[model samples]
Target: MIWQLDLILCLFIIICAIAAINVKDLLGAVIILGAYSFFMCLLWTEMGAVDVAFTEASVGAGVGTVLFIAAVSKTKRRSKD
Candidate 1:
């Protein structure tokens, strides 16, 4: 069961990463990146690294997503150059 869950999480992370790169909207890409981070945190937890998972969840999924969205908001949604 644990291995199955880990496999699922890995697959989810991969899908989120692809979505993050392919999404046309900057905000959507940022959101997908956050989802990828969340799956990574889950993978860490499955690997018996609770502390690392907590840190990833807090920094990667939380603070990082906020920063990305803030940076995106500061510029135009679509870049001409």
Candidate 2:
């Protein structure tokens, strides 16, 4: 059961990563990146790395997302090239 959950989380992380790259809008991509990080944190927890998972969850899902969004907001939403 636990292995199944881990596999699902890994798949979800991959999907989020693909979505982040394929999304047309910068904000949407950043949001998806955050989702990717969240899944990564889940994967870490499932693997029994609680400390690493906590850090990943805090930095990846929290500070990293905020920074990416702020950076995106400072620039144009669409790419010129």
Candidate 3:
């Protein structure tokens, strides 16, 4: 495993996490979090953890994103701050 590639993916994952947390729009945050999950899945696959990556891709990036979007769509979408 190349440490450089791993570092890059880890950086991207951290960036996505921070962006997801800071984003004002609910949908945008959800999208960013989904992206974060995708990066995490990539890292897992790169590390030879294929099963973990598959689960993360299907559950975190897939169903979790869909569920978050659905919930956000049903909300008032207002933030106190």
Candidate 4:
């Protein structure tokens, strides 16, 4: 595996993680979390875990994001606190 690719993917994952956590908007944070999952899927694929990568792509980046978005759309975007 190319170390540079792994490093870049890791950096992306970290950035997504931080961005998701720090974002004030619930929808934006969910989108960032989905991006983080995609990066994680890529990293797993690069490390020779195609099965895990596929699962992550389908579940983590796919259904999970959709579910979160659906839930978010059903409610208010911000909290009263």
State every prediction's TM-score relative to the real structure.
Answer: 0.91, 0.92, 0.94, 0.93
How far residue 4's Cα lies from its native spot in candidate 2, in Å, is 0.8
Model 3 root-mean-square deviation = 1.1
Give lDDT per model, in order: 0.88, 0.88, 0.91, 0.93
Writing each residue's lDDT as its tens digit, candidate 2 over 1-81 gives: 298998899889889988889888889888899889888988998899999999999987999999988998998898532
Residues 1-80, candidate 4: write the lDDT tens digits.
89999999999999999998888888989999999999999999999999999999998899999999999999977743
Judging by TM-score against the true structure, name the best candidate.
3
When 2 and 3 are scored with TM-score, the better candidate is: 3
Residues 1-81 of candidate 3: C-alpha lDDT, one tens digit per residue: 789999999999999999988878878888999999999999999999999999999998999999999999999565443
RMSD of each: 1.9, 1.6, 1.1, 1.5
The digit string of per-residue lDDT tens for model 1 on 42-70 reads 89989999999999999989999999989
The residue pairs that clash in candidate 3, if any, are none
TM-score of 4: 0.93
Q: Let me know the TM-score candidate 3 reaches against the reference structure.
A: 0.94
Give the clash count for model 1.
Answer: 0
What residue pairs clash in candidate 1, if any at all?
none
TM-score winner, 1 or 3: 3
